[model samples]
Target: MAETTGGVIDAAERDLIIRSQAGDRAAFGKLVEQHMKRAYFAALGFLGSHDDALDISQEAFARAFDSRAKLDPGRPFYPWVYQIMRRLVFNISRDRKARGAKLEAATGWIVDDLSARALREGPAARLERSELEERLHGAIAGLADQEKEVLVLKEFEDLKYREIAELLEIPIGTVMSRLYSARKSLAKRLEGVV
Candidate 1:
Protein backbone atom coordinates (compact mmCIF):
# COMPACT_ATOMS: atom_id res chain seq x y z
CA MET A 1 0.00 0.00 0.00
CA ALA A 2 2.80 2.41 0.85
CA GLU A 3 4.71 1.70 -2.35
CA THR A 4 1.52 1.92 -4.36
CA THR A 5 0.69 5.35 -2.99
CA GLY A 6 4.17 6.64 -3.63
CA GLY A 7 4.18 5.18 -7.11
CA VAL A 8 0.84 6.76 -7.93
CA ILE A 9 2.00 10.19 -6.80
CA ASP A 10 5.24 9.91 -8.71
CA ALA A 11 3.45 8.69 -11.81
CA ALA A 12 1.06 11.63 -11.75
CA GLU A 13 3.85 14.17 -11.38
CA ARG A 14 5.93 12.51 -14.09
CA ASP A 15 2.99 12.33 -16.45
CA LEU A 16 2.44 16.05 -16.17
CA ILE A 17 6.09 16.78 -16.76
CA ILE A 18 6.40 14.35 -19.65
CA ARG A 19 3.31 15.64 -21.36
CA SER A 20 4.56 19.20 -20.94
CA GLN A 21 7.88 18.22 -22.44
CA ALA A 22 6.06 16.57 -25.30
CA GLY A 23 4.49 19.87 -26.28
CA ASP A 24 1.04 19.07 -25.05
CA ARG A 25 -0.54 22.49 -24.50
CA ALA A 26 -3.09 21.20 -22.03
CA ALA A 27 -0.41 19.45 -20.03
CA PHE A 28 1.73 22.56 -20.01
CA GLY A 29 -1.32 24.54 -18.92
CA LYS A 30 -1.84 22.16 -16.04
CA LEU A 31 1.79 22.56 -14.98
CA VAL A 32 1.45 26.32 -15.07
CA GLU A 33 -1.87 26.19 -13.27
CA GLN A 34 -0.26 24.20 -10.48
CA HIS A 35 2.73 26.53 -10.08
CA MET A 36 1.62 29.99 -11.21
CA LYS A 37 0.44 31.51 -7.96
CA ARG A 38 3.46 30.31 -6.01
CA ALA A 39 5.80 31.60 -8.73
CA TYR A 40 3.97 34.92 -8.87
CA PHE A 41 4.21 35.35 -5.13
CA ALA A 42 7.92 34.56 -5.14
CA ALA A 43 8.57 37.01 -7.96
CA LEU A 44 6.49 39.67 -6.26
CA GLY A 45 8.34 39.13 -3.03
CA PHE A 46 11.62 39.70 -4.85
CA LEU A 47 10.76 42.29 -7.49
CA GLY A 48 8.07 44.16 -5.52
CA SER A 49 5.70 44.83 -8.45
CA HIS A 50 2.75 42.93 -9.84
CA ASP A 51 3.59 43.79 -13.44
CA ASP A 52 7.22 42.76 -13.17
CA ALA A 53 6.23 39.64 -11.26
CA LEU A 54 3.77 38.64 -13.98
CA ASP A 55 6.30 39.25 -16.71
CA ILE A 56 9.02 37.33 -14.90
CA SER A 57 6.73 34.40 -14.22
CA GLN A 58 5.68 34.17 -17.85
CA GLU A 59 9.21 34.48 -19.15
CA ALA A 60 10.43 31.81 -16.78
CA PHE A 61 7.90 29.32 -18.09
CA ALA A 62 8.70 30.21 -21.67
CA ARG A 63 12.38 29.68 -21.04
CA ALA A 64 11.64 26.43 -19.25
CA PHE A 65 9.62 25.16 -22.18
CA ASP A 66 12.29 26.17 -24.65
CA SER A 67 14.87 24.30 -22.62
CA ARG A 68 12.64 21.47 -21.41
CA ALA A 69 15.06 18.76 -22.48
CA LYS A 70 17.63 20.09 -20.07
CA LEU A 71 15.38 19.49 -17.07
CA ASP A 72 16.03 16.41 -15.00
CA PRO A 73 12.80 14.54 -14.32
CA GLY A 74 13.98 13.40 -10.89
CA ARG A 75 14.31 16.95 -9.60
CA PRO A 76 11.41 19.01 -8.31
CA PHE A 77 10.03 21.42 -10.93
CA TYR A 78 9.22 24.39 -8.73
CA PRO A 79 12.78 25.12 -7.71
CA TRP A 80 13.97 24.99 -11.30
CA VAL A 81 11.26 27.38 -12.38
CA TYR A 82 12.03 29.70 -9.46
CA GLN A 83 15.69 29.79 -10.38
CA ILE A 84 14.73 30.94 -13.86
CA MET A 85 12.45 33.61 -12.45
CA ARG A 86 15.22 34.78 -10.13
CA ARG A 87 17.62 35.11 -13.06
CA LEU A 88 15.06 37.05 -15.10
CA VAL A 89 14.40 39.43 -12.21
CA PHE A 90 18.09 39.99 -11.74
CA ASN A 91 18.54 40.69 -15.43
CA ILE A 92 15.66 43.15 -15.44
CA SER A 93 17.03 44.94 -12.42
CA ARG A 94 20.46 45.16 -13.99
CA ASP A 95 19.10 46.46 -17.30
CA ARG A 96 17.00 49.10 -15.58
CA LYS A 97 19.92 50.33 -13.56
CA ALA A 98 22.10 50.36 -16.64
CA ARG A 99 19.62 52.72 -18.28
CA GLY A 100 19.73 55.07 -15.31
CA ALA A 101 16.28 53.96 -14.21
CA LYS A 102 15.22 53.51 -10.60
CA LEU A 103 13.06 50.67 -9.42
CA GLU A 104 10.17 51.78 -7.23
CA ALA A 105 8.18 49.71 -4.80
CA ALA A 106 4.51 49.42 -5.54
CA THR A 107 2.78 51.48 -2.86
CA GLY A 108 0.24 49.84 -0.54
CA TRP A 109 1.29 46.40 -1.73
CA ILE A 110 -0.02 43.76 0.68
CA VAL A 111 2.26 40.71 0.79
CA ASP A 112 -0.64 38.28 0.87
CA ASP A 113 -4.21 37.63 2.00
CA LEU A 114 -3.22 37.11 5.63
CA SER A 115 -2.88 40.81 6.19
CA ALA A 116 -6.25 41.59 4.62
CA ARG A 117 -7.96 38.73 6.42
CA ALA A 118 -6.48 39.95 9.69
CA LEU A 119 -7.84 43.41 8.94
CA ARG A 120 -11.38 42.00 8.89
CA GLU A 121 -10.83 40.64 12.40
CA GLY A 122 -10.06 44.02 14.06
CA PRO A 123 -8.12 47.22 13.59
CA ALA A 124 -5.60 46.63 16.43
CA ALA A 125 -4.80 43.09 15.24
CA ARG A 126 -4.48 44.16 11.63
CA LEU A 127 -2.21 47.07 12.45
CA GLU A 128 0.19 44.85 14.35
CA ARG A 129 0.32 42.20 11.64
CA SER A 130 0.84 44.73 8.88
CA GLU A 131 3.66 46.38 10.78
CA LEU A 132 5.37 43.02 11.26
CA GLU A 133 5.16 42.09 7.59
CA GLU A 134 6.43 45.48 6.51
CA ARG A 135 9.37 45.22 8.83
CA LEU A 136 10.13 41.70 7.64
CA HIS A 137 10.04 42.76 4.00
CA GLY A 138 12.30 45.71 4.72
CA ALA A 139 14.79 43.52 6.49
CA ILE A 140 14.79 40.98 3.70
CA ALA A 141 15.35 43.74 1.16
CA GLY A 142 18.28 45.03 3.18
CA LEU A 143 20.12 41.70 3.19
CA ALA A 144 23.17 41.20 0.97
CA ASP A 145 22.30 39.50 -2.34
CA GLN A 146 23.74 36.12 -1.41
CA GLU A 147 22.25 36.22 2.08
CA LYS A 148 18.82 37.15 0.72
CA GLU A 149 19.02 34.39 -1.89
CA VAL A 150 19.85 31.80 0.77
CA LEU A 151 17.13 33.02 3.11
CA VAL A 152 14.40 33.05 0.44
CA LEU A 153 15.35 29.61 -0.87
CA LYS A 154 15.43 28.12 2.62
CA GLU A 155 12.42 29.89 4.11
CA PHE A 156 9.95 30.69 1.34
CA GLU A 157 10.88 27.97 -1.15
CA ASP A 158 10.94 25.36 1.65
CA LEU A 159 14.23 23.95 0.44
CA LYS A 160 16.34 21.87 2.80
CA TYR A 161 19.58 23.36 4.06
CA ARG A 162 21.63 20.86 2.10
CA GLU A 163 19.59 21.48 -1.02
CA ILE A 164 20.19 25.21 -0.65
CA ALA A 165 23.88 24.63 -0.11
CA GLU A 166 23.96 22.57 -3.28
CA LEU A 167 21.94 25.11 -5.25
CA LEU A 168 24.08 28.02 -4.06
CA GLU A 169 27.22 25.93 -4.49
CA ILE A 170 28.22 26.69 -0.92
CA PRO A 171 28.97 24.46 2.02
CA ILE A 172 26.14 23.21 4.24
CA GLY A 173 27.56 25.02 7.27
CA THR A 174 27.61 28.25 5.28
CA VAL A 175 23.92 27.85 4.43
CA MET A 176 23.10 27.37 8.13
CA SER A 177 25.18 30.35 9.19
CA ARG A 178 23.72 32.63 6.53
CA LEU A 179 20.18 31.66 7.44
CA TYR A 180 20.94 32.25 11.13
CA SER A 181 22.39 35.66 10.45
CA ALA A 182 19.50 36.57 8.14
CA ARG A 183 16.93 35.66 10.78
CA LYS A 184 18.91 37.41 13.50
CA SER A 185 19.16 40.59 11.50
CA LEU A 186 15.47 40.47 10.64
CA ALA A 187 14.56 39.91 14.29
CA LYS A 188 16.69 42.86 15.36
CA ARG A 189 15.10 45.12 12.76
CA LEU A 190 11.61 43.95 13.69
CA GLU A 191 12.27 44.56 17.38
CA GLY A 192 12.69 48.25 16.75
CA VAL A 193 9.44 48.35 14.78
CA VAL A 194 7.34 46.41 17.25
Candidate 2:
Protein backbone atom coordinates (compact mmCIF):
# COMPACT_ATOMS: atom_id res chain seq x y z
CA MET A 1 0.00 0.00 0.00
CA ALA A 2 1.53 3.27 -1.07
CA GLU A 3 1.21 6.07 1.46
CA THR A 4 0.23 9.58 0.45
CA THR A 5 3.49 11.49 0.39
CA GLY A 6 3.43 15.30 0.56
CA GLY A 7 -0.21 15.14 1.60
CA VAL A 8 -1.57 13.57 -1.59
CA ILE A 9 -4.81 11.60 -1.37
CA ASP A 10 -7.07 9.23 -3.23
CA ALA A 11 -10.77 10.08 -3.46
CA ALA A 12 -12.39 7.47 -1.20
CA GLU A 13 -9.93 7.88 1.63
CA ARG A 14 -10.10 11.63 1.14
CA ASP A 15 -13.86 11.56 1.76
CA LEU A 16 -13.37 9.52 4.91
CA ILE A 17 -10.67 11.84 6.19
CA ILE A 18 -12.78 14.90 5.55
CA ARG A 19 -15.75 13.43 7.33
CA SER A 20 -13.55 12.28 10.19
CA GLN A 21 -12.05 15.70 10.48
CA ALA A 22 -15.58 17.12 10.51
CA GLY A 23 -16.50 15.03 13.59
CA ASP A 24 -18.46 12.39 11.77
CA ARG A 25 -18.52 9.43 14.17
CA ALA A 26 -19.14 6.72 11.61
CA ALA A 27 -16.50 8.07 9.29
CA PHE A 28 -13.97 8.07 12.10
CA GLY A 29 -15.03 4.54 12.95
CA LYS A 30 -14.42 3.59 9.35
CA LEU A 31 -10.95 5.03 9.57
CA VAL A 32 -10.30 3.07 12.77
CA GLU A 33 -11.55 -0.12 11.19
CA GLN A 34 -9.18 0.36 8.29
CA HIS A 35 -6.07 1.12 10.32
CA MET A 36 -6.37 -0.45 13.79
CA LYS A 37 -4.94 -3.84 12.94
CA ARG A 38 -2.00 -2.34 11.15
CA ALA A 39 -1.38 -0.07 14.09
CA TYR A 40 -1.54 -2.97 16.54
CA PHE A 41 0.89 -5.09 14.59
CA ALA A 42 3.20 -2.16 14.06
CA ALA A 43 3.23 -1.56 17.80
CA LEU A 44 3.71 -5.24 18.48
CA GLY A 45 6.72 -5.38 16.18
CA PHE A 46 8.16 -2.21 17.64
CA LEU A 47 7.53 -2.84 21.33
CA GLY A 48 7.94 -6.63 21.28
CA SER A 49 4.94 -7.18 23.51
CA HIS A 50 1.28 -8.05 22.95
CA ASP A 51 -0.23 -6.05 25.82
CA ASP A 52 1.83 -2.92 25.24
CA ALA A 53 1.02 -3.10 21.56
CA LEU A 54 -2.71 -3.32 22.21
CA ASP A 55 -2.73 -0.59 24.84
CA ILE A 56 -0.42 1.80 23.03
CA SER A 57 -2.12 1.33 19.65
CA GLN A 58 -5.52 2.09 21.15
CA GLU A 59 -4.18 5.10 22.99
CA ALA A 60 -2.59 6.40 19.84
CA PHE A 61 -5.93 6.12 18.03
CA ALA A 62 -7.67 7.90 20.86
CA ARG A 63 -5.09 10.67 20.77
CA ALA A 64 -5.48 10.92 17.04
CA PHE A 65 -9.23 11.33 17.46
CA ASP A 66 -8.70 14.02 20.07
CA SER A 67 -6.36 15.83 17.72
CA ARG A 68 -8.46 15.20 14.65
CA ALA A 69 -8.42 18.83 13.61
CA LYS A 70 -4.69 18.60 13.06
CA LEU A 71 -5.02 15.77 10.59
CA ASP A 72 -4.34 16.59 6.98
CA PRO A 73 -6.93 14.90 4.79
CA GLY A 74 -4.54 14.90 1.88
CA ARG A 75 -2.28 12.55 3.85
CA PRO A 76 -3.04 8.90 4.54
CA PHE A 77 -4.61 8.30 7.94
CA TYR A 78 -2.57 5.26 8.95
CA PRO A 79 0.79 6.96 8.57
CA TRP A 80 -0.40 9.91 10.59
CA VAL A 81 -1.60 7.68 13.40
CA TYR A 82 1.60 5.69 13.07
CA GLN A 83 3.68 8.69 14.00
CA ILE A 84 1.87 8.95 17.31
CA MET A 85 2.28 5.26 17.98
CA ARG A 86 6.00 5.31 17.19
CA ARG A 87 6.66 8.21 19.52
CA LEU A 88 4.95 6.51 22.42
CA VAL A 89 6.91 3.33 21.83
CA PHE A 90 10.17 5.23 21.57
CA ASN A 91 9.63 7.15 24.79
CA ILE A 92 8.76 4.04 26.74
CA SER A 93 11.72 2.13 25.40
CA ARG A 94 14.10 4.95 26.21
CA ASP A 95 13.01 5.31 29.78
CA ARG A 96 15.89 3.97 31.89
CA LYS A 97 13.86 3.13 34.98
CA ALA A 98 11.03 1.46 33.12
CA ARG A 99 12.81 -0.03 30.14
CA GLY A 100 13.97 -3.23 31.80
CA ALA A 101 10.61 -3.94 33.35
CA LYS A 102 8.91 -3.22 30.07
CA LEU A 103 11.25 -5.54 28.22
CA GLU A 104 10.59 -8.29 30.74
CA ALA A 105 6.90 -7.85 30.25
CA ALA A 106 7.28 -7.97 26.48
CA THR A 107 7.74 -11.69 25.93
CA GLY A 108 5.33 -13.97 24.00
CA TRP A 109 4.55 -11.37 21.31
CA ILE A 110 7.25 -12.92 19.19
CA VAL A 111 6.24 -16.48 18.46
CA ASP A 112 8.51 -19.04 16.92
CA ASP A 113 7.11 -20.87 13.93
CA LEU A 114 6.90 -24.38 15.28
CA SER A 115 7.48 -26.92 12.55
CA ALA A 116 5.57 -30.17 12.04
CA ARG A 117 8.62 -31.93 13.41
CA ALA A 118 7.91 -30.49 16.83
CA LEU A 119 5.04 -32.96 17.04
CA ARG A 120 6.81 -35.84 15.37
CA GLU A 121 10.29 -35.53 16.85
CA GLY A 122 8.97 -35.13 20.39
CA PRO A 123 10.54 -33.46 23.43
CA ALA A 124 14.19 -32.95 22.48
CA ALA A 125 13.45 -31.27 19.20
CA ARG A 126 10.76 -29.20 20.81
CA LEU A 127 13.17 -28.10 23.51
CA GLU A 128 15.80 -27.21 20.93
CA ARG A 129 13.34 -25.18 18.91
CA SER A 130 12.17 -23.42 22.01
CA GLU A 131 15.68 -22.56 23.04
CA LEU A 132 16.59 -21.26 19.61
CA GLU A 133 13.43 -19.23 19.50
CA GLU A 134 14.18 -17.66 22.86
CA ARG A 135 17.74 -16.96 21.85
CA LEU A 136 16.70 -15.39 18.59
CA HIS A 137 14.17 -13.22 20.35
CA GLY A 138 16.80 -12.04 22.80
CA ALA A 139 19.21 -11.34 19.98
CA ILE A 140 16.62 -9.31 18.17
CA ALA A 141 15.62 -7.53 21.35
CA GLY A 142 19.23 -6.64 21.99
CA LEU A 143 19.57 -4.59 18.82
CA ALA A 144 19.51 -0.79 19.02
CA ASP A 145 15.96 0.42 18.65
CA GLN A 146 16.62 2.09 15.31
CA GLU A 147 18.07 -1.08 13.82
CA LYS A 148 15.28 -3.12 15.29
CA GLU A 149 12.73 -0.62 14.00
CA VAL A 150 14.16 -0.89 10.51
CA LEU A 151 14.28 -4.68 10.75
CA VAL A 152 10.73 -4.93 12.02
CA LEU A 153 9.30 -2.56 9.43
CA LYS A 154 11.05 -4.25 6.53
CA GLU A 155 11.06 -7.92 7.50
CA PHE A 156 8.06 -8.30 9.78
CA GLU A 157 5.82 -5.70 8.23
CA ASP A 158 7.04 -6.48 4.70
CA LEU A 159 7.35 -2.82 3.84
CA LYS A 160 9.33 -1.72 0.81
CA TYR A 161 12.43 0.39 1.20
CA ARG A 162 10.61 3.50 0.07
CA GLU A 163 7.70 2.83 2.38
CA ILE A 164 9.97 2.28 5.37
CA ALA A 165 11.89 5.42 4.50
CA GLU A 166 8.71 7.42 4.21
CA LEU A 167 7.37 6.14 7.52
CA LEU A 168 10.71 6.79 9.21
CA GLU A 169 11.19 10.18 7.52
CA ILE A 170 14.56 9.08 6.19
CA PRO A 171 16.03 8.51 2.76
CA ILE A 172 15.50 5.14 1.09
CA GLY A 173 19.22 4.47 1.14
CA THR A 174 19.29 4.94 4.90
CA VAL A 175 16.47 2.47 5.34
CA MET A 176 18.36 -0.15 3.31
CA SER A 177 21.57 0.51 5.19
CA ARG A 178 19.90 0.16 8.56
CA LEU A 179 18.19 -3.04 7.46
CA TYR A 180 21.51 -4.42 6.23
CA SER A 181 23.22 -3.61 9.51
CA ALA A 182 20.35 -5.07 11.49
CA ARG A 183 20.39 -8.31 9.51
CA LYS A 184 24.12 -8.67 9.81
CA SER A 185 23.90 -8.23 13.57
CA LEU A 186 21.06 -10.71 13.89
CA ALA A 187 22.87 -13.23 11.71
CA LYS A 188 25.99 -12.99 13.83
CA ARG A 189 23.93 -13.57 16.96
CA LEU A 190 22.09 -16.53 15.47
CA GLU A 191 25.11 -18.17 13.86
CA GLY A 192 25.02 -21.08 16.24
CA VAL A 193 21.45 -21.99 15.48
CA VAL A 194 21.52 -21.74 11.68
**Number of backbone collisions per candidate:** 0, 0
lDDT of 2 at 105: 51
Q: Over the stretch 1-194, how does candidate 1's per-residue lDDT look in tens digits?
A: 11111112255656777888888878878778778897887776666678888989999999988888887655556667777877887787667657855335633444567687887989888887777777766677666556667777776767788767655557899999988888888788888665
Q: Runs in model 2 with CA error above 4 Å?
A: 1-8, 96-99, 105-107, 114-117
TM-score of candidate 2 on Cα atoms, chains taken together: 0.88
Q: Which stretches of candidate 1 lie over 4 Å from their true place?
A: 1-9, 95-103, 111-136, 154-171, 187-191
- lDDT, candidates in the order shown: 0.72, 0.81
Which pairs of residues have clashing backbones in candidate 1? none
Question: Candidate 2, residues 1-194: lDDT per residue as tens digits?
Answer: 43543345677888898998888989999888888888899888877878888999999999999999998877888878888988898887788335465365534777645744575779999877877777778777778888989898887888888888878889998988888898899899988886
Which candidate has the highest TM-score of all? 2
